[model samples]
Target: MGRNTRKRSKTTGGKVMAAAAALTLGAGGLVVVNVYASAHESSGGNAVKRSSQGSSQGGTGQAAASEASTIDCPDVGNGLRQVPDQARAEVDKQLALLDTQISEAYQRLRSSTRALQQDGNFANNAIMGPLKDKRVATIDRIATAMGRAGDRPQGLESLAACTLRASGNQSDTGGNQSDTGDDQNGGQAGNGPVAADFVDITTVQPNVTAPRMSQEASRGTFATQCGVNENKLYNSDNVIVAPGVDNGAHHTHDYIGNQANDAFASNDDFAAGETSCQNQGDKSSYYWPVLRLQDGTEEFDAQQQGGGAEGNTGRILTASEVTLEYVGNPGGKVVAMPKFLRIITGDAKAFTNGTANANAAWSCTGFEDRQLTDKYPVCPEGSSLVRTSKFQSCWDGQNIDSANHRSHVAFADPATGACPGGFKAIPQLVQRLVYDVDAPSLNDNGRSSPFYAVDGFPEQMHKPITDHGDFVNVFDEQLMNEMVQCINTGRQCQ
Candidate 1:
């Protein structure tokens, strides 16, 4: 909640947007013809899958670390919902295909939606009726599935991403438009990243609103963005769109699929926060800010093509970044904003550089992003990005270690009888802070910490410091132990 950083003003029905985010899928080959008008809400999209459709290798979901142990959300279930690795692998393959298809469809709908909205001739009554009908029909199908998900609620990403597939069946708004032609013409319907489908996100849903300033700010107000993952219920995904936005604000998040734009070979594999379009001008980092308007739709705002980026990537920086007060969702679940995971990394230049370091590395690629997160987004160039650990004033290894020593307790190894050295167990109190409130958690949705999960999760983690949210309660020993138990024994998880 840095007041100085968040200068933008936004007022939405008096709801304060803490650190919220939204998401938008790349358009291509996706065909979501029906639009629903029901207010019946569901949670999250399907689990992210990897594709095998293209000649390209399956976009590896996060790489599995044999050394890494999955934190059993014991409260979530008695290991009943956990899918076996083999089954999980198959899911990844299917997800990859779905991602590709959706990417294509995303491009298509984006165009159609924009045309219907921007084209003065296209009236809401004429276009929106069919759209609403389709939306309603689709929502019914989605609602039925949600009803079937049973009492064990699924992750918001999974529920939101219902399995909707399209075989590039619909006619693109810009008929016969291909990638090369769109690029040569520039700003044509297909000029943006071509989706398997047609249109950009804005056109289809004309009234779609991104996240805005909290009313809290307007009274000459103040605010906070992502907290220390304290509140489990709120985050970008948990948002319930207003009653009028998407046909009475249908809550069933309908999704087609996804694609891996990870063009960098040195890419650490695809992760959501970074840009895929190779910067032509050659800069260190691409600023892609995932934003959400009041309506609850998501979109990508990236570095200026003027700064060597591409497409609306340049036009997007209008708000750039802004922190807000608690939007209700303490940290994860239903954040008021659109998307999660703010930046790709602290080091701008070497995101692809430390590809040489096998011990621990950061990645921008979708597949590689999985395992690297445990170590966090460090690059060979170190922390050069602003407002991150890499910043000049930020602590070095020694200082960081010292801070941990002062604030944290020794991590006791379960297998061994001794406590960890130079390492501290993430006090259960702090687990939510590190897991839910940190930068990665703040800006990410879909899969858990697709990154982050590394070697010493429950037993030892980074000390709560600058990176942790402000809600860290030093005196809350009981709360801390609760968190510690959650970390060590996976207790009281829901």
Candidate 2:
């Protein structure tokens, strides 16, 4: 199925609910609307209350009274299913520009508190109007490039207009907002990760289940020992998504496995790069956004573009343990993944794009059975925080990547554990990261104890739901065959 055809489905109030809406720009220009559904209901326990405060890092503290508001634009990248190879580069550049535009507009919204309070129409008149004009021109360039190479994408102009949306923190809040006196939200930039973003793991019921294995199941697993990013390799460039764009991710990523990965790294660079894995033949690149503690300390990227300057501040916390394992499909034997196969498991913009592509799984060490997708888990004293990502296990067996960077691979069926027709099952990379950090004290909005959040785009508000991971397969032919053989024979190999 196409990426745009999929809808986010969640089980709430004992019934599965799927809500989706889209906006089209008319002759009048931009139409302001809320495109996402309400926040997921807390399974149990009383709702947490939140308050707005100025960010110590110079945020203007101008969110709406009830919830933090941000600019929401239709994701143009998600709708582009096809772009000719000749136009791919230009399309990617345009997509990156689109992201940059959104980030810039969001920054304006966050900084204009006085204007927002003084003039009710300030956001629509100043921010949204200019943003739509820029987007229309950028999108036109993309369409022209694609038309010159292949077919022009239709209905792209409809995506140019943007609107203001309250970040999905409505249902999660209850009682009265608390004033912590200290002027800071969980995030140093005051953009997000408020008290409502976290929930005690113990209060959440067990929600994970195992898929049934068939007789043809390839039950073996292959584990790669890539150290926990001990070398401290980090960057904001995304080679797979925006190959030639700097700060394409708008957030720093902690890299392991492959040593030579950045926005400028080509396929050849990845092939010739050094490996951090114990097995020299396995040079795959694995990276995820760095998690940061919202303490007052400034890190190396404090003054950098994709770091503190972009609202991703705080001390970067290296994962205590990083486990990269490839497991087989439950329905049948798995095939070797193609070289340079790029897979992004979660959605970094799930906060605005909705959860159709969200795959973040958070839990405590002992409470692994209870995974929290929307809320950050507050682990007890002895327990460590965990972030788990299970990558797409089925490949289309043709392209190494797609225009949207997601169409080439797909997750197995939730119930049947089978690959879609015409696609082959591949060994799925299951990454588990363990972090040792103190739980944030939610009552005072993490004032006494700082909140820890995964790095994301500034406008994404450091939402836990936006947590994502990326991987590029660079295993040598020998190691790749060995892994496939080990899996088919039902033997665990490393």
Candidate 3:
């Protein structure tokens, strides 16, 4: 979020704040592949397993302690829907492999779908049909593996039916055939800190629409003055690495705001920092690990490389623009966002843990009619790549941050989009990340293709369904007051 004082090579960390002291300035910061089966262990592919038991347990599933502690899973009745805990590890291992294979196949289909100009039928016949058949086979193997682990195997049908399918948006009109090989997203190519060679054409998927905000809030055009910019890379400055890492999560994150963000970063440190928010008084920071394409030739900081950091994997390009917006609670309610409040939205373990918390919206800049759920949208030329990560709007009105990082905040009910009992609604902060990556072309190889997908996140990341968001409240008392004032008065302030 700050400027680099000196130029440093890849060997020396490039352009970072000097020594965590710029006058204490601050800044800030899927899919479901559920593997919660009890099965026999099969050693193959990537040895990845996901557990929602929090960072401490090496998974990103819900941090629902109450649910975890109270679960006295009944003794196996022949028809019980749950699998035994003893078989979870082995089942998780096999499911992780399956998750990877399925995601890769989906990626291939998406690539082909775009290459064939949004021809869903063609892509399905040429790619998806076989992939689905293969998926069926994989599911059978997983079932057998789970049965061997001494657990009941009744959930295989759900797993087998969880195939990837993209809805055809009749309104989508293909991409440009031109290829200039120019890096147009303001990122430098050839010998700059930026990674990958971006194509010049901006793929536009017209008629795409943004995800629906909870009905509790209005779909008014009231937007903040915060606008969008390319230089604002939201790297992780203060977040624990994974559940167990002492410092920031094991992997590096692009963060916003200058505050200290880790277990050790005290509230005071969080309060004092430069913010990307237009209101300098507001010190909240937002962030997420950068998503990279694993094109073999890509070079990532040592931390981002897998087997190094918790929650770390892949080498993605820095985002093209980070759009930050602060909206009053959709329900027209406003409460002082309790200080030091932290809430993580989206299930990080959805891809591999069989959890259904993934709520991702993929669209092109102008494609208001064509939208894709849980998958990246292929944009036609002249349009930009866009992914929106929306957060839960309800708060429990009690805790700042929870042990599970999520239980404190719950999503509004699906039917009514309203907060549940004991929960208070707060401002809906949204992070819309736009990238330049596009559909596949004949020039690029599968592994090296410049496509955007979250599949490579650690097996624990729960790919495809893993697009998520994080938030922390460090607003100065005065700024917090202004936010309330704006909401209570129904005046849209930036």
- Please provide, for model 1 over 1-494, each residue's C-alpha lDDT reduced to its tens digit, 9 standing for 90 to 100: 00011111111111011121222111221112121111111112212322222112111111111011111110111111222322222222222232223223333333343343333223122322233344334333422333343222233232122212211122223345343233212221222111221111112212213334333211111122222212111111101111111111101111100111111111122122222112211111111121111121122312211111122221111222222221111111111111111111111111111121112222322222222311233212221111111111111112111110111222233233222455322221111111121212222211111112111111111101102111111112343233333333323321
Write down the lDDT that model 2 would get.
0.77
Per residue, candidate 2 scores C-alpha lDDT tens digits across 264-338 of 776777888899999999999999999999886799898887888888889999999999999988889998899
Clashing pairs in 2: none
lDDT of 2 at 63: 44
RMSD in Å for candidate 2, one decimal?
A: 8.9
User: lDDT of all predictions, in order shown?
Assistant: 0.20, 0.77, 0.43
lDDT accuracy of residue 231 in candidate 3: 40
Q: Estimate each model's TM-score.
A: 0.21, 0.86, 0.53
Which runs of model 3 end up more than 4 angstroms from their true locations?
A: 1-251, 293-297, 300-315, 368-370, 414-417, 442-448, 455-457, 460-462
If ranked by TM-score, best first, what sequence of candidates would result? 2, 3, 1
